[model samples]
Target chain A: MAYSNAYAPSAPELPESFVEQQLDGENRYHYAYQYQPTQQFSSSSVMFPPETHPDIVKSFESADRDRSGFLDESELRQALSFSGYEGISDRTIRFLMFIYKNPGDSLRLGPKEYVELWNCLAQWRSIFDRYDRDRSGKMNSTALRDAFFHLDYMLPTSVLQLMISQFDDGTGKNVELCFDSFLECGMIVKGLTEKFKEKDPGYTSYATLSYDVFMSMIIPFIVSYD
Target chain B: MAYSNAYAPSAPELPESFVEQQLDGENRYHYAYQYQPTQQFSSSSVMFPPETHPDIVKSFESADRDRSGFLDESELRQALSFSGYEGISDRTIRFLMFIYKNPGDSLRLGPKEYVELWNCLAQWRSIFDRYDRDRSGKMNSTALRDAFFHLDYMLPTSVLQLMISQFDDGTGKNVELCFDSFLECGMIVKGLTEKFKEKDPGYTSYATLSYDVFMSMIIPFIVSYD
Candidate 1:
């Protein structure tokens, strides 16, 4: 089973001191440590690039400094506080609790768990940015409407206002939407507006149209008349 | 079967005589000729109530001049080109011809058609007004982005830009979107970007999540690496 340089590329057991070369472009796994979402100027428009969540990986990687993947309370607390969470915000670590779903007290997530966290957090962040069209650190009625249109195809102006109202939490009775309450909702499509608001003939309903395919013929499927 | 009116409710029929009755409030057949969409706005929101077209049948009554269900070319042209179409120059009309599927056809629309037209044109108007968030009628990049975010997601920014770029046409590119374009294209989605740009990985491609449901989740689908 002896091998030469051509057959093995390098000594099979030379890892003790051999230096590895990094590839050009995205091939570098290091990229997993520096990803960021592209800029978005408006909710009506989307500016996205691929491969987000590098920062999350960097943090998680740091928490798992020993490369053992799983993090104990100390590592978890450090990661949590670094991520902008208070020491004990929800009274329970949902992420850790989630890992315990398989039963037993084995709630620790290792490297694989860390990767999954990055993926989820990364996408959630992106969704938040998408809704915040102005990316001025806030989203407004127009941005949310644009998002709703892309989402369903049914947002009567009133229903839209209601969705905005839910997040308004302002002193003014006439509350329009902005980025103010975004963080409150966790950035995921947790409780998006229903398909339509049921109303009579005079009742208004608008379907939120987001994506498209095939021909450009406008397809206004009343996802729900209600 | 003959039906009798309890209180001689003004018949859905229009009086052929020149009647100056106030038409009373809550008149089913003619509530000041108000359309829900048009009525919801404040004086500041819209440019002006779309001039009731000559053939618009403000009441169940026919047009005093045209006597048609939908206004004829002359009547609609007058309505569309009124002070509403104010600065629109002839050169602007020429450009609109290329952008719209059937631009040169006689300028006329029925009630249903007018609704479709307003839905699209009104959105563009909002963009213009949004740039003037303070309603100052001027804009900067911040204003532009905010206006853009406020724009419908299905609206194509490039197409909008093309329309504005041609503004120097002297005639003013005030070609309001008519019914045909809407039934044919503009109605396809909310904003133009949705028509083009590739899906960002930031999003879950909500197309995948509820591929069978609707597009509303697309915004939350974008993953924020930032």
Candidate 2:
């Protein structure tokens, strides 16, 4: 597949050779390598585009033991595990529900939403694998920056540093982010930016918010997640 | 003043000598050392306990330059600096307004709320100082834990570790928290615990929450502050 640079016009410029290297067949193979599992999953059981996948639908129905047409937290937990994401944290699950649920919906996930969430997770997993350059199941600061750049988020250096320190695994001297932390960090940046954009509709990067407005807008983001 | 152990029944037991050591005149002197400024501020212009302090009231009136009887963000920023807390972050100031303002009040602070806020800052400053064992203006993980213990919050070790890593200054190998980070860390733990307590009124350390309740409660804390 051809890499598209059209969406990332604001992305910081890099050396021409570096751009070419990233687009070369080897790197394309890397993307393909990480995406192979999803392909296999599609070919073996159901079609691609998880929204229509029979396995996902079956998993959700089976996990919804109460047959309420919605999966509660515990049920969602089981459903996600069945979809190969085991031991997902309660905080992450809550975050997922917050982002994907339809308006007027409770915290639970209906089948359609669950399938969409499964697709989202698959995308995040693919991103994680592509950035885990050493195959250590973690991304160092440089890899993290590159991954976000690939995703079209030109985060400031200070913000990137904050994310690194906030999500450091405490293993040792080196800072690294596992898959879950990467997801959380990315979602937080995306969510906060969206909130800020609401106040700065002109994309001016400046917003004047009354304290109450600021608190009301930010408090939910701060309090609800891990 | 005599040290009180009466409020911290759940605090981890220490050697009798260690307890005595902490209560000795030297440690008491350390507390007094940090408290000296507030004492001087009280004696020179107004009394302590802050609420009735003439100086605090005057500061508030001066900060309310518009004579609106409330201090907006910029005015509150100046007022905090006047009270010796220089360069307070906008996030911290908003958090203070969230905690101190009356139910119907807007983001700005009235005279009564300003005075109360000053008192609260003094208390937090004292806590930060007491735990900054080497007078380094920062607290390490151990000091951070001990400070919470002294405050009657027996946070689990895992939670303490999370606080340390989350608030690390990134200066070097050591994880140290400066005063502002300390204040944020303590407030987050206290705020989250209070929210959790509402659902676990029996103090059972367990609560059953629907996904909606969990997200609504936790998101505010996650989103609003730094």
Candidate 3:
């Protein structure tokens, strides 16, 4: 029930008219943030809006059950996962910590440091929870595949399979994902497709970057900062 | 007053500590969506969540002054502009209409189509408003320039000038942007930077892309869809 309420509106309920259009094969509905296979969105230079940090702090501190004044990685990960990043991975979570940490405190996150990371994670959670239909605390592989397609990605099944495997919760079942792992997968696909779109701006809807570019640009961000 | 209240919490309110960090030349905090000039985020294949659409409809219909059963371009533009996209242009509004319109009704947008377009514009507005610190309905050149930089772009002033010009509202004053114009600018900066990162994924805070990508991938998206 907890997850269900969180995901109650996952498929942003469109009016019947639009749904009819979709059923009639008129896939004309396009979301502004809908990932375009061949287009890149401009990045904004402003930092997170100042007012949202408190709610994040609230959430972070609330998740800090022991009141340690800092959230250990696992606690932070658990907090984020339950809050909506159901499929994010340990690796991606670490990278997030790496990118958002305070100067002296590398491993544990203070409230100030945690707020910054929380802002981004919150956005990711909003987006992630939107597509997490079953609310089973994980996006099953089939659902994961659909999520990508909805974002206009056409990844190969093998790649999708491997991605799910990386975040498999060791349940002996290989198809579902938690928030951290899901975020990791989304980031990679968005990152690569964004690149391909840049190179093949002719509306190819697909692009091929050099291996060098792939290695140099796409790989480092995801591989872990440690 | 309503709009102001709505916007009051738009920026994540950081505690004093983070503010101190920002003031003290410690720009250590970073957004997850910060467009890295280099590096790729793996793409997650998921569609936009459906629940968020109704709130969009409520906003859109509330903005419909004449109650024409649809939001004309200007009404739509005004709604979105004041809502958060302070410097959005007529061209981008039209393009939004084009991308979100029903097949037969190209000129006027009903709540259904408007909700989809509103979703993207709402996002643009969220990012745009955060940078409109004064709430002046415009971001001056310095602010606009900083907005791009914050998104990790290092655009040549010439390119920035051209971009500002294209979306200029023709007020004879060229130093600032309304929501329409600002949204147009943000799109280009984010689009190109996203691509560059895919190629130059090193730790460079800035990267460069060809003019061709700008003209193709981004330019088309913001131009009039009509």
Candidate 4:
């Protein structure tokens, strides 16, 4: 395959399995990460859902605190909060802004950009909601583990504890996860997972690579914003 | 668990499964990455194989081309080449040197540091040998992906292609992986896989974490050298 400045190829058409609906939730989760090609960034490729849902528009308006017809980082955070997400750090908000912001415009998200952001957030929220089970506004460690497992990452438990300790808002003994934190974890794991799969043109959901190939080549891009 | 500057608490005692003899090669591969805890970095914590293999000493001496009683980056590359490994880029060699070299002394590897680097490289070599079934000196793409799969990463094929293309000796169509490149890829994937499992306290092969928890706290370290 030709290497281009484009970080990823165009978002692939939804695969047969996705359209066929044969996949269970777990399989669908894996399929989404494993099969959905990493999206390339270009103004033309900024795919908004065919039509913005009314709820999304209303939520976006609510977040437009100044009603400037745009959503800045703060407004994006507010919108996420209004939609029942909390604990989103400024860094993460900025990252989404960087990813979705229109070409040559970094100040704020116009309505089209806002809808794109809103839809993606909603998708992620639904993922979080599925595992929150009790809807307690926070997820315990088990819920968190299952959430990732559903995404097909069967990571070890100690790593999870260390990960949780990094953000567990409760007193020392209690471990809980809120939506924003979950979103952050999902993004990194999912993004890396997709990058790992880029070699599998065969779509066998697997690839073979050596350590040197990853470090000198893949990791820089993983760390790079540009 | 208490958060400490310590990367990993003293390497947990090798698990009983490792001590038991029933594990097949694949199972052993799984055990090393999936069950083996991520190693921490402390000078005192550096664990060498109980005894130095004679081959390591011989190779180190050869790489000490000038017989200065130390191995610099160029020497390290030659030594690795002598051990049926070649095509290691200078940058990768330097990174390993920086990783394993003693803090105050960056010039070269003395005998002690040489043994440590030798042991780690030897372990990585054995891993490559398992996949290079033909002893052809280069691994094809399938071998590369299976190597990671054995280490518990189910990365997709395209990612593997992107990874391989970076180091593929082939002009445009052929994909070949020599040992040095494999070692680098294995190290990063293994390291990241272990980090992913760090959250799993139970050793149940799974953990749950939120994106915010991971991004705000863990990602910087993932991308950072120190």
Q: Which candidate is the best by TM-score?
A: 2
Return the candidate ranking by DockQ, descending.
Answer: 2, 4, 1, 3
The 10-residue segment of model 1 chain A with minimum total lDDT is A16-25
Off by over 4 Å in 4: A1-50, A62-69, A103-107, A156-162, A168-174, A202-226, B1-226
Query: Between prediction 1 and prediction 2, which has the larger lDDT?
Result: 2
lDDT string for model 4 (B1-226, tens) is 1111234432222223222211111112133322222442223333223355657667777677676766777888898788756676664575466445443343366656666666667676777788899999788889988776665556555456545644532232566767767766665554444444455445443334332223222332232111
Candidate achieving the largest DockQ: 2
Docking quality band of candidate 2, CAPRI definitions: incorrect
Task: Tell me the tens digit of each residue's lDDT in model 3 across A1-226.
Answer: 0001122223222122222222211222241222122321212221223454444545665567787766777878876765555555555666565434442233566654565566556655666676788677677888887776665555555455445543533232655666666665665555444444445556544344432232233322322121
Greater-DockQ candidate between 2 and 3: 2
Query: iRMSD (Å) of candidate 4?
Result: 14.5
Cα lDDT tens digits for candidate 1, A1-226: 0111122221111111001111110111122322244553223222223342445555555665565556554565566556644443221243232322111113355433444444544454465578776567566667665654544333445434433433433222444433324432232222222211111122232232223321111121111000
* Per-residue lDDT of model 4, residues A1-226, tens digit only: 1111234422222223222221111112133322232442223333224455666666777788786767877888888788766667665676566445543343467666666666667677887889999989778889988877665565455456545644533233576767777765666555544444454445443344332233322342232111
Q: Quote model 4's TM-score.
A: 0.38
Question: lDDT score, residue B33, model 1?
Answer: 31
Ranking by TM-score: 2, 4, 3, 1
Q: How big is the positional error of residue A166 in model 4, measured in Å on the Cα after superposition?
A: 3.8
For the record, the alpha-carbon RMSD of candidate 2 to the native fold, in angstroms, is 21.9
Q: Please provide TM-scores, in order, for all candidate models, with all chains considered together.
A: 0.25, 0.43, 0.32, 0.38
**How big is the positional error of residue B44 in model 2, measured in Å on the Cα after superposition?**
22
Model with the higher lDDT, candidate 2 or 4: 2
User: Candidate 4 docking: what grade?
Assistant: incorrect
Show the lowest summed lDDT stretch of 10 residues, model 4 chain B: B20-29
